[model samples]
Target chain A: MISFFKKDFLVHWRDRKEIIISLISPLVIIAVIGIALPGWVENPTKTLQIKVALVNADDEQAAMQEFRDSLAARSLPDDELLDIEQQLEQLSPIRMLKQVFQAEHVKEIVSMEELGNDDALQQLQEERIAAVVTIPDGFTLAALNKMVWNDGEGTALRIIAEKASLQVGVLNDIIDGYVQKLNVQSAFHHLLGADAGAAAIASDDYSGIGGREMVDGVETVTSFQYYALAISIVFALLLSVTMASKAITEKRERTFQRILLTGSQPFHYLMGKMSAAFCLSILQLSIIILISHFALNIFPGRSLLFWLGVSAVLVLLSLCVGALVVLFTALVFRLHDETANGIAFIFSLIAGTIGGSFVPIYILPDWLRSAGEWTPNGLSLAVLLQWIQTETVADLSVPLVKLAVFAIATIGLASWCFPRRGRI
Target chain B: MLEAMELRKVFKGRTAVDDVSLFLDQGESVGLLGPNGAGKSTTISMISSLLTPNSGDVRLNGVSIVSKPQFIRQVLGVVPQEIALYEELSAYENLKFFGSIYRLKGKQLEAKIQELLEMVGLRDRQKELIKTYSGGMKRRINIAAALLHDPQIVIMDEPTVGIDPQSRNHILETVRLLNREKGTTVLYTSHYMEEVEQLCSRVYIMDHGRIIASGTTEELRRILSGEDTLLLKLDKPNKDLANVLRSLAPIRHVEETDNGLKLIIAKHSSLLSQIVQTAESHQVEIINIHVHTPSLEDVFLHLTGRTLRD
Candidate 1:
């Protein structure tokens, strides 16, 4: 084993062409995305209300006052209330609100001449406005039945809103939702009953199932911690494929056979290349781990076990991948001429993606994830995540055993595929 | 000493190496001469234990290498046709890796590396990447790599296939010198007739997975002595003249050559009289005639009726 490891160490330390395959890409990816774009909170919540800039074009005061009174009556949470207050002080669109809150949604009012050539809607969204509500000019009588709390006034208030933007459509949703809520409150108070406050008090005792936490009745994972973990794992898989491809290329070039001629056993040759792969993988995962903590600031080493568990899986995954790669490399070397490297590359990539290296299982459709879980790549990723999250080795009992099974099974398969040839 | 007893290897549906056997005594040099796909490499691979013969035994110094390949592996060094040194490492580094495998290490390994580098005439450029070296240099280092362990027998498989003539000569001379001075037993394989004729004490000519002939170079050539050779060149070619010449007494052989025809006759005999009469009758002009002894190529041609590669 010392002899084998020495061989591996010499090859890796001396060979730059093969070294880059195992090192550069993963580090660069970590540096560019994980480090450069640090603090990417993957699962952002809409619970914190955003403030928007509003501009009103109303010529009347009575309708504006009534709209303001209706909007103020909304029993919003403290954050949303503060956001709304800040936005109104900035936009003052309520001074231009056309009706009392009867309609489900209200449009924003703006003089085209006053609005510059800038992206006003984008400005609203970025400034935390839910949406821009623009109301057209009209007499209060024209909307007596359509309006929520319309007491006939001088002229219709034209409200100019700046809230919802296109990407994620979050800000616009908040503004539209608040508009509807205030409209209903206005209707109850102005149209049917004078006991709108009492009605709200009675109906406020409303709670429902956790829709956001459970997406479509499945346990939803909102944290990007899982996504980062998944990407790094795939990167690790790609690293294995690269290492495997080199092994195949070397064999084809007769380097491995030449080593054998030097009194090196088949196992020594196999384990040497694998040890090189395993070491490089450990280095790669270390860099990725450091990226998550120092750069992304996500998934900090929760405890010693979390780190240890990740390291252990990485080692196992590297070995499994190395075994699989060598088997393919050996198979290609024994069978094909000049095309072995290409075959290994295509095979490793196929295996990597099948193992969920590119797209995470959670992001993939349910059918894809279910079918993909059996593949070595997918199982490796799942096993890793389970191992990382669990507190003890006992909790990882099944996954560790399954990983061992995968390693042994792949080695067996590779052994079958790479049957010794060119000799009697 | 290296020995192969009835070595044979069969591939998918073909017998790549058929019942073949040869032996090399300590300090003695031998050659395997054959065409492409003629089982020379297969034989070498078996002897080197890179391959396991289907039914045979290779013994290094009387130890059964078939059951225990490690013995042959340890006692043998191989110079494969392809330049198998790692392109990524310097020539020194490549040799270091190979040397360490044979249990050479530290100061001893470094000293051997330096000594071998000087032996191959590349001591100054040892640190350069193997990839950057020219073909001849790589071949020299390839040979140097084999010498790293100083094994009892060194097997070379067409080691100078594509090197320059100067490098080829230099490598052959180095092999000859090593064998002469150090008594390094060598099993040199090549299709190049002249190389084996110059360097080997005995030659084995293989064809269609079988050794057609194996003996001392001169001894092998002596088989064709029964048929004396004759050469004839004519101004006007006549097909009938050759048959007429063959009927003459004291003449043993007649064959075509590039310039004209050749005739082989028995020792202390002359057939020019009958040949001149026959050629004159056939209206053929005789140009020149001469007799020469056989060569390794001739021995191969006499046995297999073709050159090594053909």
Candidate 2:
């Protein structure tokens, strides 16, 4: 087994092009993307300024104020007054919408400019603004009627942006949050009636809803920190494929058979290939991490313990990637080299996307985000990112266990697929 | 001793080895001769334990090794038809790796590698990468790799295919030494009849997945004992004269040639004088006349009616 591993190690070392490509490709990708992505993701307010038109088109503001004054003049009972006040708060959709945009994260993401309908639409087309938010006329009155009387009428807000623009999605997310909050309020009013709803609303806690925790006292995460680890996972997978390709070449050259005939078992050959991949992955991961830590300064400025935790997670991830490629190669052992290449490339893309190697997990749909966290790559990055945020290794146990299970399952599958006494 | 009894292997409903049985004494050299796709490789693969026979079993010494292949595998050395050594590694490295697999290490492994390299006549070039070596040189290293462990039996499957004559001769000489000096059993397989004829004490001829014949070279040649082949080198071509000679009663078969005519007749037939006289009468001068001995090639043609290379 040692002999098999040594042969594979020495062979890969002799291939200067493979070694160079494995080490250099990740840095190049990270550098290109790190330089190309807008700096807004790193420091939203200090970087590129995206403009949003916040149009207040509600013409019923005067009427709603007059209604509130009339209710006060009618000398209503104390409990009735309190119920009306609670209902008024629930009916303030425009206020709720304005507050969501005013939040720190969104405020940093886009600068709002109040504009008329025509000017906002014109600005959006001219690319002066990323999106336009139009509060329709009678929006306040409609919202009030829906909440106070359980009216079935619906109100709509208009948003205009270029198709598939990132800012449009961000704006939609904020609006969705407001709509969810309104639904919760409406449900409570229908369940308890105005008097009981007022009591329930007063006692209900709203502090935790849509709340953001500052990691290391900073609300923003740098894009470099993301790709620093994301690209490392991607490149680690590609390097493992390169190792698998070398294994295939050895099979084609008949050296694999030679080793087997020398009394090395099939799993011994697998161990050799796995060890080579694991060793290279560690080297690749170490170099990429160290560069990100020291040169790029993308890693959290934490002590050695923090980086050690991060490294431990990455090591497991690297092993999983290596084992994954081994299984992939074994499954496609009879294919042509080109087909093998195509499979590897397509697998990398899919695993990267599903594992959050190309995009941050938090930005994905909830189900997909959950799925990404379970994947070896995403879990590794999650652990790293978590360690960076908490500056501790407390949240690493689950991911480490997951990574171990993934590695074992893949290695077992690969071993089972490997031919025991024949050419593979 | 290694014994294979009634071994059969069917691949996807097509039989590759059919009820084949072979045995090797501790020190005897055995050869398997056949054309391409003739089941020689399949037979060796079964004996090497790299492949399992669908039926029957192979035994080393006394025990069947089908379930416990490593027992025989440990004592066996196989050099496949392909150049199976790592091309990117030096000959020394390749030998060391194989030696390690056989559980040899330290100075002992180094000494054995040196000895095997010397045996294959590649000691001075052991440090060069195999990729840098000539085809013949690579073949020598390939043979050297198999001998590193000094196994009880060495199985070489067409080891000299596609190499220069020098390397082929070197490999033959190495096998001769292993069999003659060290008394190591060998099972040599090849399509090259001359290689088997030169090295094998006993030979097995296979065609279409079954052994056609097995014997010493002389014993196999005796299959054609009753016939004598006569070759006449003519000074000039004469189809009419050849036809006239063919009408003689003793002649069994006559085949035209570029420079001569080959005649097959009864072993005891004394028709050479009659044929020469007949040729001279037609003004067809016989420049030289020679008798042809039956070779393994003739035996193969007699059995399969196809050349070994075909």
Candidate 3:
């Protein structure tokens, strides 16, 4: 058995170019994916800078002068005069709206460009601006009347954006929070009247629900980790295909017969082949993962135990690769050499595709994603990604068990199809 | 002695080996001779325990080895028709791997590989990959690999199939020495009649998955003793003259050749004089004429009605 293992290892080692080439595909995949997916893999807390046209048609000074004139005409008593002054001080709706766009989080995410309503719509249609927020010419009187006296229709902040873009979603959520806070302030004003209502508005916190809290000071997995795992599984499948071809080449070269003549049992020979494949695959995965970790920083903030858990899952994946190679070679050898090679290549390609090695699983249709998860490498990628997010052995149990079952089934079929001596 | 009794094998409803049997004594160099697809390889495979017979048994030292293939394999060295080697690895590495399989290691395995390499005339090129070697060199290494374990019986199946004359002669000589000097039991299978005629004391002539005849060369040739082969070497081609000679009553078979005509005649016939007179009348210059006894080729023709390479 040792001799068989040593022979396989030496033969593969002599053709080191193939090994290097195999390692290259996965790296290229990970690099291309990391570069292609820009914002998705980044820290969720990172803000987006959207250029929005702010069409403010409100004439705030004119509205304030009109309100003071109306109050002077009343010639109110001393207490009534004090109450009116306080109400006037609290009635800066234009200032409040401006502050909404200037808040710390909102300011980082959106930059306001003041423009006429017609020009804002033109910029929006041309796609030069991400969105348009039009504050109508209602000025402050409408807001003050609607809030304190409930005498007129409330002013609306008209927002225009493309339905498909992330900018639309961000702007909509932010505006929704503002509307909610304003309603809370309105309710307090109705209950306590104008003088004490100003205090209620001060305490209203409009931070959106999607805020990121630093958990254990550890960052979540980046986009690099997703593609790194994806590419690793893909190349591992390719490696299995090569291994099957290698077995066929050996059979053609007649080296398999020589080994059989040396009194080596069929089981011993297969075990040696599986062992060599497993070792090489594990080694390949380890190199790829470590390079991605240290160079590309795939799973930043992962602990030692996290990596160890990853290694354990990778070991299972590598064993599955080994068994898959055996099964593919055995099954293909039942046909002519050329036909067998074609089938093996097609099978590998299908497995890679369904395994989400080329495209991210989340982008796939729901049914396809579910179907892909049942595939060998697909399950492996899913379990691994989950483990990266929450490093726990329990998360790997289903995939690990499924991989074991798959390995057993493939190995058994391989044994059944494997040609014994004198048959070929 | 290694013995195969009533061995039979079927592949896809075709009888590849049909009730064939043969034996090799402890120190005898036996040859299994047949044309291509004549079941010689199949027989060798069964006898060497690399293949199992469907309805027969093989015994090593009077005990059935069908259930104990490891025992038979341990005592058998097989050189298949194909090179059966790792072309990417060095010749030395190939030998080391095979030696390890037979449980030989360290200095002992290394020394055996060196000795075999010297025997096969490849000692200097041990470090080179087998792929870099010529066809003849590969054949030599192939033989060396089989002999690594120094098995009690060496079964070689067409070992000299596509090599140069020098390597071919080298391999025949090497097998001869192994059998003569080391007293290794050998089962050499081939379609080359001269190789078997030169190396093996006993020969088994197989045809269509059955051994048609098995005996010493002299013993097998005696089957054709009643007829004599008349060899005539002429200066040039004489088709009309050869046709006239074929018309004679005493001639059993006449084969026209580039130089002359070969005729099979009765053991003591006056056809020789008639043939000479006819050749002179046809103006065909006779370079040489000789009457010889039958050989293994004739024996094969006598048994199978075709040449060994048919």
What's the lDDT for all of these models?
A: 0.65, 0.79, 0.81
Worst 10 residues of 1 chain A by lDDT: A104-113
Candidate that scores best on TM-score: 2
For model 2, residues B1-310, the per-residue Cα lDDT tens digits are 8999999999889999999998999999999999999999889988887778999999998888888877887788888777887777999998998889878989999999999888888899889999899998988888888877778999999999999888888889989999999999999999898899999989999999999999998899998898887889999888888788778887866767789898878889989789988988988889999899988987887788677998
The digit string of per-residue lDDT tens for model 3 on B7-112 reads 9999889999998888889999998999999998888877877678899999998888877777787888888888888878899999998899878989999999
Ranking of candidates on DockQ, top first: 3, 2, 1
Backbone Cα, N, C clashes tallied per candidate: 34, 0, 0
- Candidates ranked, most accurate by lDDT first: 3, 2, 1
iRMSD per model? 3.2, 2.0, 2.1
Q: For candidate 3, what is the DockQ-based docking class? A: acceptable
Model 1 agreement with the true structure over B47-98: per-residue lDDT tens digits = 8877888998888888888777778776678888888777767898888888
Scored by lDDT, the top model is 3
Cα deviation at A127, candidate 3, in Å, is: 19
Chain B TM-score of candidate number 1: 0.85
